[model samples]
Target: MNNQHDPLSSRPLVSSQEYSEVKNEDFEETACEDSITQRSPSTELPAYKLRRSAWYPDMRVMISREVLAVHLVWLLILAATIYVLGRFTPEVKCGVSRLPSDVVFGDIPYQIVNWDEDSGFVNSDPLDGKRWNQSREWADSTDWTPWDDIHPGSWVQVAPSSKLGISGGIPLRDYSKDGSWDTNDEGYALTMHHQIHCLGLMKHVFISAERNEPIPSTSFRHMDHCVEYIRQSIMCYGDLTLEPLQLGSSQKAIESDTWGSKHFCRDWTALKEAVWERSTVGFDRHGFVFDKVIP
Candidate 1:
């Protein structure tokens, strides 16, 4: 090293007091900068940097208060959307996903029924307990019940059915103890049962005619109601199967036969399943509908 005339060897190139002042100023500036950096990276911005990070934004810097507020609002909106979808919409099952909708109703299927008019149900003797046994599904009303108990209504008339249920699948009742009000009991019979009951009445009337006995006034009333009911049911069922008039053994024009009449029909099974699921009180003969849903 050149020791002579060197700045280090000679009196300082700059005065000691000046150097100390500069050094002190440099040290103070560096310390101030370090403190500012610890508090925040930006000077113009507020000292709002947080130690903890937002769950969504894992950046080293804190999220703005306005931004955090917006995120909370968005989350609330999402929750509300989910709630609305679940509340107002009707839940209909569609594969893995259930669709909620009032416009989409359930399905009712169909089947073919080959009517057997020659069957024992009608062809047998009315007095042989054959014609009337059909109505016996409900508690025996053979001069027992005071009024009609198998059915439910203010009116004792207007209904019947078939391929539907044993007794139109209606819940039966014991009318034996009832006076004016309808009483429900064991056994199930639908509207068709009522029609069958009417037929049974007609059968008794037929036996009376055969024996030359006077028909009861009630029997006449029942016969009239039954005739009207059957006529209306035919209109309602709308069995459009074409039945051409037939010719008798004498080659004369004879009435068409109902035997083996193939009818394109609503599938009782599918409709039955849907009915039970939706029915307030069903084949089990219990309860009525509540809140428009089967409980």
Candidate 2:
């Protein structure tokens, strides 16, 4: 018989060689009483490959559970700090108010029609008719209608972000030396809309100069100076009221004489008087005009 094929010939005759008897001391004496599997105290598990995330480098070091948790917490804190810093940094450019414009002086941007005076110009539907109500007037009302939301024709589009070519907020309505008399909110005084703030100062300075006399178109250098002046003057308004909302004893105490003048109403009045006196004496041919409108 072939030894490879014959089962009896291939198997060993000695049964004792294949099996060994365990000593009674080697086995747990109390295993049956406890009813639990017996395991050797010296046994060890085989080493296996460790898996890791692709983003993190596998730093081959024996790490404890507490150590690994600490590392993860530190990484999370670092990521959060970077995110917060990016939010506050001014990445995109924008102005506090309207952007600078290319529109120069003497450009004749829009036409003004005196609606109340029929004899002056032919009345167009828009510029010729009684378009607004004149009954509601604020005590500290100014000639400018820039902030008046009621009148449809008085609002001019402003590029507050500086992306648009326009410099500052311009009221849609215009009033000149012509016989245009209407309390209907058709036009605004030059200083009406220039709020008591640092923003839109270049436009305010230009308007102020234009109202005073035959000044040339506003220069870029002059605008820079005006912006600095406005910043210094109007910074106080952030904490307190610079311009009063109405006219009265209480209003006079809080409000400015001119809307944006840095000085208080009482002080601005004194300054105006001084300017007028100087002009009258021919010390200065033209003095600053400080006119506050009250309605």
Candidate 3:
């Protein structure tokens, strides 16, 4: 058999299945003319341009309304700068960090100003009234003591049986049941010399306490009404009984010339040295002072 021209019938016809059947008949005639140019509805898109660039708005929609009006003008300028810094600021306050006063005041006798007016209290007053019975009867005839060199308005005398001792809270009456008045330390120095003769008999002088007894001419008229009540109330008045001086070496007492003739005063050693020098300046033992301060 003479193989017809051999090499698989002369190898010259290229095909790949006739070039895939003419590329599938030219892609079905270009999809039938692109579906007759999209069904020929005037050949394209239009119904309001197929309505959509994000449903009709443009330049990135005014760049999203200028980014929401610049985030609502930066949230209304941060809420009007926090309402104008809460309507014009300024309320800070803060204080309290203290510790520095030291305490000074010197000359003292009366103007203390605080810590309860140094203590004697004249202000909040009331601690057994009549201004503490006229400041303990004007400190019993303007108190004085080195055992009694009587000084301020003097007129000493006192004696519900002497040796003074009525410390404040007064009420130790029983002047032997009934004589009502007498409360010790010579009936509290004759009720503080009748409340210093009701505070206004001017030039101090009090003396009244001779309920009876003792002589040397009524102790020289009770020592001449204590040297005419310290020579009509202070500023000067002397005579401290010349001699028997020594107060400690076992106590002694015999120079009593009484007030006017000076010397011999001891309303319990002048109200215990004017209640320890008016309670060490702050004035207490009834003078009342220790002022006050408390936020």
Candidate 4:
């Protein structure tokens, strides 16, 4: 072909190898662009661009403190609520709800009688000398008095023989083998009597045992003396109504007669009625109602 007139020679002539190399270079550039476009945003983005301004160390610390403070405030509020509820709640009272079936002994309410002038124990040492001698002799004697003929003062006559039984003798003498006086034994007896007297006085008076106040030894002794007087009267009169006797100058003796005559002797039937009235017939949640019955 003539170079000046040929159509293929009109444009710049390229080698076959050069054209192939140019096509391959263009394909390589396209593949590099596609790989860059497909890469993850995290790997492609700058560190500054990926992190927010609010997520800086100082800002993060401030946010954590605020969250912690909110939790602490809520915890404090909950604790305070619990404390208030505990402080204001009413206390619950516990006790037995039922009455007892056993016979309950209680102190009979009696007025104090002032008969100090006529007490039989006044200036008389019943524990020693002539009285002691007589008592000792009487204890050995075999003379017996019928229960029907017994009177208020008759306890003195029957006490010697009755002492052989469980209930009649002074606790100290009864506990001793030779009937010797023991201060400790006497104290123990008095303590027992005091307990019994307190039970009698408080019987059926309180709905719950926890509500009852402790009885003082002095008060127990006073009540015991009064009951002892009544016991003597019961022993003597055998339910007979007798005039109140002058028991002597001792306050115990005088008070005994005063209270005993009014409660035990003068109105013996009434006393029995009172006991019946005070007794309960139902089952008890607590233990026995009374420790002992005086009569």
Comparing 1 and 3 on lDDT, the stronger one: 1
Looking at candidate 1, what is the lDDT of residue 74?
A: 100
Taken over the whole model, the C-alpha lDDT of each candidate is 0.44, 0.33, 0.34, 0.35
Supply candidate 2's per-residue lDDT for 180: 38
Q: Model 4: clashing residue pairs?
A: 106-200, 107-200, 119-247, 119-248, 119-249, 120-247, 120-248, 121-248, 122-249, 151-236
Model 4 alpha-carbon drift over 4 Å, by segment: 1-44, 47-56, 90-295
Worst 10 residues of 2 by lDDT: 280-289
On the 0 to 100 scale, the lDDT of residue 159 in model 1 is 20
* Model 1 misplaced stretches (Cα beyond 4 Å): 1-109, 125-189, 266-295
Error of 4 at 123 (Å): 25
Full candidate order by TM-score, most accurate first: 1, 2, 4, 3
Ranking according to lDDT, highest score first: 1, 4, 3, 2
Clashes (backbone N, CA, C under 3 Å), per candidate, total: 14, 9, 31, 10
Rate residue 255 of model 2 by lDDT.
41
Q: How do the residues 1-295 of candidate 1 rate in per-residue lDDT, one tens digit apiece?
A: 2223455575323322222222334234443444423232332322332222123353423557768889999999999987775544545454222332112224444578877654444444443332223333452325222112222211121122221111232332322222332434223323444565655567668867888998778778878888998888788667679876788777876978757778877675664444343223322221110111111
Against the hidden reference, what TM-scores do the models get? 0.37, 0.20, 0.16, 0.19
Whole-model lDDT for model 1 versus the true structure? 0.44
lDDT of 4 by residue, 1-295 (tens): 2223447666543322222221334234433343434333221333453364325656979999999999999999999987654433332224211111111222333343433353333332222222112234443224322211111111110122221221332333333334443332211122223333343333312322345756556655656665676567557447443456665776446523444343232233444454344322221112222111111
